[model samples]
Target: MQKPLTDFPTGSVVRIAGIDGGRQARSRMLAMGMTPGCPVTVLAGGPTGCRVRVRGSEVVLCCGLAGKIMAVADDSDEGPRCNCCPGPRARAI
Candidate 1:
């Protein structure tokens, strides 16, 4: 059920499965705290780019970069879920 980040609608919560790109792309994303298995929420999107919340920060990514991020919908009903980068946290914008 993996889909590109750009493919997910705004307000969707998904878990990053993998990144499809070169080493540089992977490294940049990792440094931005977008590691595999981490939860990400789509904040807003348009034709050029989109904003997403991950690792306690909101990031704006262009379509190219966002398209490289593969994530799966987090539809699990399990309570209090946590993962590699810790579950979503609340932070003031």
Candidate 2:
């Protein structure tokens, strides 16, 4: 089922469904690799914003930006397993 980005729980892997915002916002998101169909995993969330793991990169997104991203929880077992390497740490805001 589809849901807002803010509703997604931390650590939940999801696929970008669509964006809901004006052209400028969409363009910015696109530049950041948040285009529709992209896979993203919610890492943390809080008052300021949320952090998401996308394509092995950890990106911190503000609530406004996060709100524009629409995604569906990925319940598939066919994707590659994550290799949680020791690198940048992620914490709930």
TM-score of each: 0.80, 0.75
Lowest summed lDDT across 10 adjacent residues in model 1 is found at: 84-93
Judging by lDDT against the true structure, name the best candidate: 1
Indicate the worst ten consecutive residues by lDDT in candidate 2: 84-93
Compose the digit string of candidate 1's lDDT tens values, residues 33-73: 88876778899965577799987799999999999988877
Off by over 4 Å in 2: 46-48, 76-93
* lDDT for position 40 in model 2: 83
- Residue 61, model 2: lDDT of 88
Runs in model 1 with CA error above 4 Å? 76-82, 85-93
RMSD (CA, Å), each prediction: 4.2, 6.8
Q: In model 1, what is the error at residue 63, expressed in angstroms?
A: 0.6
TM-score of 2: 0.75
Clashes by residue pair, model 2: none
lDDT of 2: 0.71
